[model samples]
Every structure is written in structure tokens, then in C-alpha cells.
Target: MAKRCVPVTVRWSDMDAFGHVNNVQVLRLLEEVRVHAFEDLRDHGGPSLLESGVVVARHEVEYLAPLVWRLAPVPTDIWITAVGGASFEVGYEIYDAVDGAAGGGGGGPAAGGERTVYVRAATTCVAYDLATGAARRLSATEREVLESWTDEPVPFRRRSR
Candidate 1:
């Protein structure tokens, strides 16, 4: 699947005293991107990816570099990595959008510049029936919808190479 990228603004409050984005704020950034993804699917008149009784079961994040304030919005890429009976995994790659290099953080630094990764993360979300308060299997329609966003799996570990 093609990567879905959203531009995210960095608020003044998002910066820490150290003059960089706080570690926790990165999670908020991820949340913004995640919500945007689900809302896009929801707007298409399909099942609500978020409102239809879905809850985050796990969130794992890795901070790769410090993100300083920038006028341009940060570009975030999010996609589905895994789909299971009652849960699915959503992955995200967040990085500085500098020098018009949006979504370019995955690559090495430019010859005369630097493009840094702010975070690489994933969330496992479980589908639940609110009334029953239990996990519910994904329906065929839901699975199909989610599969549309599925992409190549992202490694959780940082490679030495």
C-alpha cells in the first residue's frame, strides 16, 4: 500500500526546556497522525476505525533523534502492519520536515544537511463491543477496509547496518 502521510504542527508547548520536542510529545504527535488515519477511513462512509469500539492495546515508540522547532509541519507516515482476529497493528514514522524533505527522515542525512527521525512507533488496537466489554472479531468488511491500508512490515528493532 502507498504510504499515508499527514503534516503535523509543532506547538510551542510541545517543546521542552531543552529546546527540543519532549519525548512524551512525540506520542501526542503519533496520536494526531493515528487519528487522522482513522478519520480518513471514517469519512469514506465505511466502518469507523476509531469510534466503532476500538481501543489501543499497546503502544511502542522509539526516539531516534531530537526534533527542534520548525515552521513547516512535520510529516508523519502511518500504515497498517498486521491484522489479526481481534486486533491489528498500526505503524508510524515521524520525522522533521525540513528543507522540503517531507517523509525523507528514513534516509541518511543529505550531503550538506541533516534529516533526522523523531520517532518510529507502533500501536496494537483491539476491536471490542462496548456493550459486551470484550474483544470482537473483525468483520469481513472491516478487514477488507483495513487491508487497503496494509503495507510492508516495519522492523521494530534498529539495525546495526
Candidate 2:
């Protein structure tokens, strides 16, 4: 599936005492991406991931490096990792804004510049019926729409800190 790359605004309140984005703020960024990606579904009268009945079942975030505050927006790339009967997983990669282009940093850091990965994260969300208060199976169209954004499988494993 095609990945969605978005330029996210970094507000002053998003930073911590160290001038880097706070850990919680990073999750908020991911949430923003999720909402954006699912907007189409809601627009078409389908279940809304944010306003409708979708719920975050789990979130796994791996912080690779701190992202410093910059006037330019941070580039975040998001894709669907998996789609199930009633739930789906979204994957995200937040890249350091080097070269001033969307995900433009190439190779590794050079002597004069550095390109780094700020965060790698994933979220699992389940669809639910608001009135019934129970999980709802994904409609055919819903599944198809989500599958269109699916990427290669991501292994879920822990690494030593």
C-alpha cells in the first residue's frame, strides 16, 4: 500500500525542558497521523476512528532519538501494518527534518549534517458500535480501504535499552 507522509507542526508546548519533544507529545503526533489517515472513512459515513467508535487497544513506541524543536514541520510517514476482523495496526516513522524535504535525508549522517530517526511507533485500534458498546466486525469496504494502506509485516519484539 502507499504510505502517507505528513508534515506535522511542532508547537512550543510540545517541547520539554531539554528543548526536545516530550515522549507524550510524540504519541500525540502519531494520533494526529491516525486521525488524518482515517478521515476518509469518517467522511464517507463510515465508522470514525476518532469521533466514531474506534478505540486504541494498544500502542508500542520505540524512541530512537530526541527531536529538537524546529520552525519547519516534522515529516512523519505512516502506513497500515495489519488489518484484522475488527482491529487494525498502524505504523509510523518520524524522521529528522534534514535537507528540508519530506523524508529527504539520505544514507546516514554526514560530517556537516545528520539524518536521524526520531521515533518508531505502532497502534492497534478496534472498531466498536457506540450504541451496542461492543466490537464490530469491519465492513467489506472498510477492510478494503484499510488493506490498501497495508505495508510489509513488522515484527513485534523487544530490544535491550
CA deviation > 4 Å runs, candidate 2: 41-47, 101-115, 154-161
Best by TM-score: 1
Q: Write the per-residue lDDT of candidate 2 for residues 1-161, one digit (tens) a residue.
A: 46878778888889998888999999998888777768855666555666557888998898888888876788888888999999998888888656654455566655587556788888999988888999998878778878878886544346546
Kindly list the per-residue Cα lDDT of model 1 for residues 1-161, writing each as its tens digit. 55698888888889999999899898888888878888888787568877778888998888877887776788888999988989999988886555454455456555676545678888999999888999999888788888888987766666434
User: How many angstroms is residue 113 displaced in model 2 relative to the true structure, after the best TM-score fit?
Assistant: 11
- lDDT for each of the candidates? 0.81, 0.79
Model 1 misses residue 124 by how many Å?
Answer: 0.5
- RMSD, one per candidate, in order: 4.5, 4.3
* Clashing pairs for predicted structure model 2, backbone only: none
Number of backbone clashes in candidate 1: 0
